[model samples]
Target: MSEALLDIRNLELRYGAAVAVRDISLQVHPGQLVAVIGNNGAGKSSMVRGATGLVRPSGGQVIFRGEDTTRLPANKKVARGLVMVPEGRLLFPGQTVEDNLILGAYVHGGIKTPRSKATLQRVLELFPRLRERLHQQAGSMSGGEQQMLAIARGLMAEPELLVIDELSLGLAPKIVDQLIGVLADLNRTGLTILLVEQLASYALAIAHTAYVVANGRISHHGPSAELARDPEVMEAFLGRKKTAA
Candidate 1:
């Protein structure tokens, strides 16, 4: 079997006296879209933070490309082509869209790579709407547009692994569809994606593998299509009412 692109083994995280995540283990392969779905306070965000070194894991290991990167700093991770588009669309309110994208390449030690322009051009093509608003302040755009900008900024880093948190949060269904479509296209281009989403149905639609997180633990793990069809998995993650087919 091919080596996994990213691996989390027995990962645990804590906040003060409370355990936020426990024994969370997962593997994401190259060119695959892996979805981590859960309700609020289920340690989903903690897992993302731990993986990116924003929150240190109390135990276990995070291995990326055959290296034990559990102790690597966030900037080092990004420089190694591991990037994240955080939960909120954390764009600079006063900065132009182009500036915000340029900031994403700061992890490369302020030196511009040859692929920078090509990456930006590709991101603009993925989000054609953004090209028109490049000079506009990110804060002035609509929520959907801001989210696009956020994802585009992450793409600017030319990541080997992209972690997206709360992708469909607080957006219209149509906008969510658009964003998800773009993600699917990116995944098709061999960009490994680890997507953290609150909407189970949406995540399962495009993911190759799925993990259902609850009470800081993984409740289910299986093929995305299989999980989507399992009544128990559906009820646990998507809720009974919404999962009825």
Candidate 2:
């Protein structure tokens, strides 16, 4: 079996006296799609922040590519192929779509490099709407388009392990379905992904392995299909008792 691309061990994050996350350990192996599903404020976002170095964890370790990166800065992590598309789809509002993509390639040698140019082409292909609006201000696009741009920007970084937080947030069902398809296709192409999502059904459908986070720790984990059928998981998402086998 191939080694894990990202391994987070017993991670802990705090805000003053409050604990956002505690003792969370998860793994995403090469070419695997792993999902972490939970309700809002379930520490899902906090876990991603700690793992990506956007916020430092108080304890445990973050190992990427067989090395300790617990103390590395976010920019350094990006340079090493660990990139994240954060929850808010934070883009440069005033900048054009093309400019935002160029910024994403900064760690890999900017858009001028041959590799960066190729990545940009591939990203545009993945989201043809982005190609059409390349010269438009990023902020002017619809929420779904903005989200697609955020993901495309992450791809411009040439990440080996892509971490996405809250992928389906605030989008119409049709748009959400389209984005889910895109993620599945990306995974089929061998990209390792660790997705933190509130929409459990969609994430579980595309994931191979999944973890259920609640309060501040993992409460259940296993194959996505099994978890989808789990009674407790069903109740949490559907708010109704499960009657199916």
Query: Whose lDDT is greatest here?
Result: 2
User: For residues 89-132, could you state the per-residue lDDT of candidate 1 as single tens digits?
Assistant: 78898999999989976775432676787778888888899999
lDDT of 2 by residue, 100-174 (tens): 999999998899989999999999999999999999999999999999999999999999999999888889878
Which stretch of 10 consecutive residues in model 1 shows the poorest summed lDDT? Answer: 236-245
For model 1, the stretches where C-alpha displacement exceeds 4 angstroms are 109-113, 238-245
TM-score of 2: 0.96
Candidate 1, residue 55: Cα displacement in angstroms equals 0.9
The lDDT, on a scale of 0 to 1, for candidate 2 is 0.91
lDDT of prediction 1: 0.88
Pick out the ten consecutive residues of candidate 2 with the lowest summed lDDT. 236-245
